[model samples]
Target: MKPDEIVVGVDAAWRRSGALDWGLHEARLRRRPLRAVHVVDESLRSDDFAPIRLDGQVVRPSPIPRNDRRLVDELEEYLAGADPALDLAADLMIGAPGHRLAERSASAGLTVVGRRGIGGFARLLIGSTSESAAVHGDGPVVVVPNGWQPAKHASAPIVVGVDDHDQNDAALEFAFEMAAVHHVPLWLVHAWEVPAPYTWNAPVANGMREQWEQAARQWLDTVAEQWHQKHPDVDLRHELRQSHPVVALLDAADATGTQLIVVGGRRHRLPGLMIGSVARGVLHHATVPIAVVHEHRATEPNPGQ
Candidate 1:
């Protein structure tokens, strides 16, 4: 199944169904055809065209019995049953699951993987696969956590964390798009760094905190000006904090009852091996869905400097 667009990344785990719904939602949002990919271990070395079922909570069962039960067939049947409006296709690939899916994400508008995958990627647990997508994938990566049901979170706002240390435009773009699509509000949160004063002057040290707090506001205002102008209808709100970015981000998401948290990684000098601390930190701690957008410009210096 080689159709040209794949916006959702999925595996064969039980969570695959949730991943499917996630992809469908994304397709509906972008108004494009949807593609679901299943990447098995290269050792299996076979393009799987076997039958499967989509109605059941699990994948390997006879819930929807039929002779021509290919993986994509089950998905197509499910999509058709679910909604005839979506244009969908699917395929199979044999490779290292995490890296292969991340590689596939290069051409996608966004790559979404489940909290847990199956096959080679699932062995090390979902963290490795989802983190690999967030850290190295070319486009933005959305990690749907366990028990992620859209019905429950449809009304929640989208939260984005920004700082001067890394690029924030990509995050803002994603957040605004999500807000616009769901007709929800967007929360723009900025958490500044608190470097300790080098000297023993307590008075001067106390002044530094105030200066940094002021800087955080300026950073939020600058980014907000550009983003809010483009999305005039979005209910945009901002927060400035002197606490750790990760803690602030998680807390803000919780306080605002947000369903998704969007963050950005700084451009790595080596390109494939590194990611920013804030993005990595929130990935492990946030209870809601997480989307990590990579820095768009390699030459753009960290604005925090």
Candidate 2:
């Protein structure tokens, strides 16, 4: 894989989302080959503002409209002026946003999309294209939240969510690699809540609750120890929280000034459902940049099922 090749999906609402700048900044920093895909809806390519139908499907012209060519030219010039090492290219593809991005992402080192669109109420709803990319992209999808400004120094730490599972190592490794590249620390966070295991004879008994919580802590400690041994030189620290994973991660981000949050993606097996919950939580709510490591395949049943 060419680590220098990064792809970003840009839509008509890109200027409003302001994700273009954030994406370009990262690509320039890494001196990677940048690909910007603008998927035009067929309905948008109309002289009379009428949708165009082709092959039983609407077709929108690719690469943005001629009116927007100036912006693209400006971006190209800025990239060349800011970094001579950066090679930039733009593609205007006509297709479904989600499908086009997913298909192209297989060969990209990274893919970036904005969280929301342009408008008052629409800004509150995450963009459907971005949501699809997050859940389906072959490579890591960077969710640039609305109003996110690229840091000048990029010194903030990388935070990763971990649970007792085999794929947790992938998330940890990704987090450390990011930290190493940015010269920042890594915060290994594990949030645990005692399972509300109950019996038909009675409600959940608190008598054994403490025991279960203790066991959970022990599991976190064991995982943390293993990771620490492997990454001895990495500036790493650990946190074990007795709260919901989603809320705990938010609180940790606030307390630690985190710039990126990482989590594991498990597709199949017994533990699948167990880790799926945490991944979903972060995907939906984590405010900072999220790096979801897609590891598990869907064929396996979730653990404890």
Candidate 3:
């Protein structure tokens, strides 16, 4: 699907620093509509209650319902102010927040949620409903950190992690389009390890060491040069080292100010059955946001093309 047709899912809570601006910024770049969603979980309604003993002995203490509609109204107002021309809708649901958000993501091209949501500061530090959405949502999920302001014009570049063992053309193309639309740089990074000789064996296999380094450098050059032809305007950089892909990516994020790290996710149905090593490493340790493109559909574009 084209970026213009993308449905951006916005999980807005009543906060002023909501994800509406962030989501709208993306929509503006892609020329897509935004769906602002507010989930009012019954579980969060109230917990304070009193048992009735004798007749009229004790009155029940009922906690007030969370003002879900107010949050939705506030979100609509924010959306209206953020982008007056784009198509937008606000949905309020009474169910499990995570499940509702995931279901809403079914048709969306991407989902955006605040790193710290309405509940307050503690939620940001720990695992949040947003994090759950990111891990399980069908489409690409963008987790906006606290104090994140949507640029009137998006500036952060699209960065994709390229693995020698995996098919990355799909992700690279995705990043390319995003970068092109946002008018930002595109960085292609490949991180590989140098073979280390086993202890009690040779301290250094001099011949093998030289060959390994040469192969790593050549791989980076070839991939960068090949993508450069298609994305000539994109500012590209390459990093090849003995460290792990996860570590290398985090380091690169700091050095280059990467906004998103697009990587390919495993396509297997069963859990823990077919997770790739590089993806697994990235899932656990990458510092920046991730875009995991799955490989099940034939219509999905190839990254090289």
Candidate 4:
């Protein structure tokens, strides 16, 4: 049986080579096919058509261009240069990139995109496409930093932010899988802080902090033990920190030279909503690749079920 394809968003304006490389790496590790997608927003095109240059000749866009030949050529060239043996496909789609990629994620095992795209301003740290995919994609979405080459940090461990919510199960599972694939260690980090109301009272705050720390440690221990039993080959380690989730994750990632950081993406009923604050913050600030896995997808039955 064919494995689920790994979909990656490709853009000519942004530094997308890194994203493609990361997608290829995952595809090889999971023994899956890689689909490189480039979406053209017709609404942004002048006169409902965008001109293209192919083979040193200007080609006028048709009423409905199914696919860009230039893009397909570029994708094929990249694959040939990167890995000739991998099963790779190129798709040129028309619509909003984020929405299109999210739709593709419905059947995809994983979706990968660059942290920032050309649509947003220079000051924007995270692009709309990356954020939308992470928030709305069906499964795990990995946002790779621009110009980030996976080979540079191949020896680093996979760091995952663990919490009390059930959503963290997906993140932990992905982290462990990645660690196993890369033959590296896995670090599970849980960060906690006393509530603001309790912090107002000094004595109460002290006691509450201690309790919270103990609870966090116990929870981390339980999670670690369970995952260790499941993945005996992974060198799994756990840590509890008294800091903000974003801060703790970033610090742990930096300290460990992490290759990838995994976090849980909370599902929202409403549209146009951002992902969880911690995931958003880390996506904006971290220089490393970040994978946001949705809990609903985690609970879903596997294919052919």
- Estimate every model's Cα lDDT from 0 to 1: 0.72, 0.70, 0.64, 0.82
> Residue 276 lDDT in model 1?
80
Give one digit per residue, the lDDT tens place, for model 2 in 168-222.
7667777877787777888988877656555332445466667877888888788
- Backbone collision tally, model 1: 2
Candidate 4 Cα outliers beyond 4 Å, as residue runs: 1-3, 14-17, 49-68, 296-305
lDDT of residue 180 for candidate 2 = 74
Candidate 3 per-residue C-alpha lDDT over 158-181 given as tens digits, one digit per residue, 9 for 90 to 100: 677887776777677777877887
Clashing pairs in 3: 169-303, 170-303
**Residue ranges of candidate 2 with Cα displaced over 4 Å:** 1-3, 13-18, 43-71, 123-125, 199-205, 266-275, 296-305
RMSD of 1: 8.3
Kindly give the stretch of ten consecutive residues in candidate 1 with the minimal lDDT sum: 60-69
Q: Please provide, for model 4 over 38-57, each residue's C-alpha lDDT reduced to its tens digit, 9 standing for 90 to 100.
A: 88776676554577899999
- Candidate ranking under TM-score, highest first, comes to 4, 1, 2, 3
The TM-score, computed over Cα atoms with residue i paired to residue i, of candidate 1 is 0.80
Task: Give the better candidate number (3 or 4) by lDDT.
Answer: 4
